[model samples]
Target: MTADRLQPVLAGVMLALVGFASSFAVVLAGLQAVGATSEQAASGLLALLIAQAVGVIWLSRRHRIPLVLAWSTPGAALLVSSGAVEGGWRAAVGAFLVVGALILLTALWPRLGDLIAAIPTPIAQAMLAGVLLSICVEPVRVLLDRPFLVAPILVVWVVLLRVAPKLAVPGAFVATLVVITGYLVDHGAPDLSLAPQVVWTEPTLNWQAVVGLAVPLYVVTMASQNVPGVAVLATFGYRVPWRESMTVTGLGTAAGAMAGGHAVNLAAITAAMAASPESHPDRDRRWIAAYTSGWAYLVLAAVSTALVGVVSAAPHGLVEVVAGLALLGTLGGALKGATESETGREAAVVTFVVAASGVAFGGVGAAFWALLAGLVVHGVLKLGRPSAPRM
Candidate 1:
């Protein structure tokens, strides 16, 4: 292949690896938090990878755009903090199905899309920034808790950020690998099979799970994942067909739920990697990067069991530190977006504080509450003022 083709391919692979290495542990922890066993968690990872691979390939081809798909990281974090649901993992799967159906319905109905779009951009960004705030602090916490193990990673990440900003997180990831390898060598490799497994669980929908998991999952996936995903594509001049992409991802989420995975949607950070001009000089050819990433996800799926084992074996807080480092840039961007406008500044700050508070009511997570609080504050403050004329 010519260099033109090879560059996109390389970019695709880089994005895939970065995406996987950064958050696979969070995915596992989220599954376990919702009551999944080790076997079930592996299956969930496999299912998510396969579903996203299909979605990415199909959407990239259909739209002829570098449309990347990902399982919702914020949703997973919500799950992690959601505690166990009433019906256990089955109910969680049911919630996943419900979330997927909602996304699909939104895609099929323009009104639903409009309703979500009606959410103020600053509020959404604030909520996302808040959701990410906890995890983004892990590197610092880890540094204080296990300085010997984490200091090198921070040093490498900082050095790369100053000299090669694009590779900063990837460098931290490399440092993590080195640290993990040493620890594993000292403690003995985990006994894990190389082959991937698929464990199917029946869905059980309960009001508790639906209200708690489903609603929050849908809101965060839409506000934090899909919205920013579209923005990333738009940043590179790609006009996203939002509805079609939602439909594909929603379907993928539903399919993955049967195998224990959570919601899959348009990717935000990784999508930028694939859609960026650096992926391909010819804008029209960047779709190749997404396609390549899809295939790479499939390859990762084939080794899902081993990947889970490696992450699962790592010391407590280590994986989170790496994830925190990987997401630092995203957190920075979200914060900037959240506070950029003076009109919504107060509402945005309210949203950020509420979300970061991690308050849960009626089993629902803080992200939903944050958005609600922001909207209320925004509305009340704007009550006596003239509404900005609708465009």
Candidate 2:
């Protein structure tokens, strides 16, 4: 088990970097949108890291589950949008607590977990595809805007993913860094500066924010994000306890929220690296990798907004193009897998359309709609049993 976990420990660091880069912007922006000073935001992000590490390590060790935790990208987006309407750190904290409570409560309901499992694999896959489609689209937009700059790298990435799947993601990141370096050589990139005085804001409580932001945060994090996250684990042959994992997610977010961070949840994309054969063949050993990732997250969280200062210095389009291209294979596979089966194909289509529709109500995201629609359709189809031919 020790040897099995060692290689994954290395890969886990890469996965953490990927997860951090993909969603840190949302964290920063959401914190700022909710009125956290640069320093307080940094502290909040650190708190988030602590929560994630504790959740992943404890849950993985206890359940031998290889669990991985991350802040919800969609939930962050929702929080930022919510902040736009319900401004202030107090509101954000209120929303965070509300969502945390909901996640914890949801975990208590065994039937809910069973219902989530009942979602046809194909339909769930379609929802995954729909959610990721936007991510995949960014590389093309980058190509159109700066074809001379991003095209060659995009081509190389796609080819590598097809021919050498294992190196696909890292290769893309390396290629983008090279391009970004070249761009910086000719045109100086943005300046990097540490915050003069770290800003910290005390959290306040607000009932309206709880309704407008908190509930939505929980719904989006769980229904849209965590559900598929578990599917990924199952797909890889890991049988994790849903309730326990959900509890960790809830507690993690709650801790982060107390420090002024928003929703956190199980990581789907980064989980693949740990779960994959490249990480470890012995499933039992993968926990070490998750353990290591939690530690790395703590370091990043401690560094706070300074980390953002460094990332902000890089070319934005470069990162987006690279990240999007890197995810292409995974997204394509997910989308294709979701729509492949005939039995769940139509439901899958509806799930995808509704999820990608960008609808929102009272801070809830499009995913809630998608999941709700899929469930209704799935339930109706299941219930509408044809009368047995008159015997």
Q: Cα lDDT of model 1 overall?
A: 0.86
Per-residue lDDT of 1-391 in model 2, one digit per residue for the tens?
5664468778778777767755665566557655666566676777777788778878777876667898876665444433443446766766677778778877888675566556677666665556566656777887888888787777767787789865666666666656766776788866645542234345556655665566546655765578778878899888768788878888777766767667778888788777877777777777667777887786666665566554345555655565455446656776777777776677788888876665656555555567668878877876785756986
Give the Cα lDDT of each candidate. Answer: 0.86, 0.68
Candidate 2 lDDT score at position 43: 66
Task: Quote model 2's TM-score.
Answer: 0.72
- Residue pairs with colliding backbones in model 1 are none
lDDT of 1 by residue, 1-391 (tens): 8887799999999889888877776788779889998889999999999999999999898889999999888788777657688788999999999998999998888687677778888888888788778878888898898998899999998998899887787788778878888999999988877789899999999888998788868887887888888898998999888788888888999999989999899998899988888899899999999999999999989988976777678788887787677667767888998998998889999999998888877766677788889999999988967877998
The candidate that wins on lDDT is 1
The TM-score between candidate 1 and the true structure equals 0.90
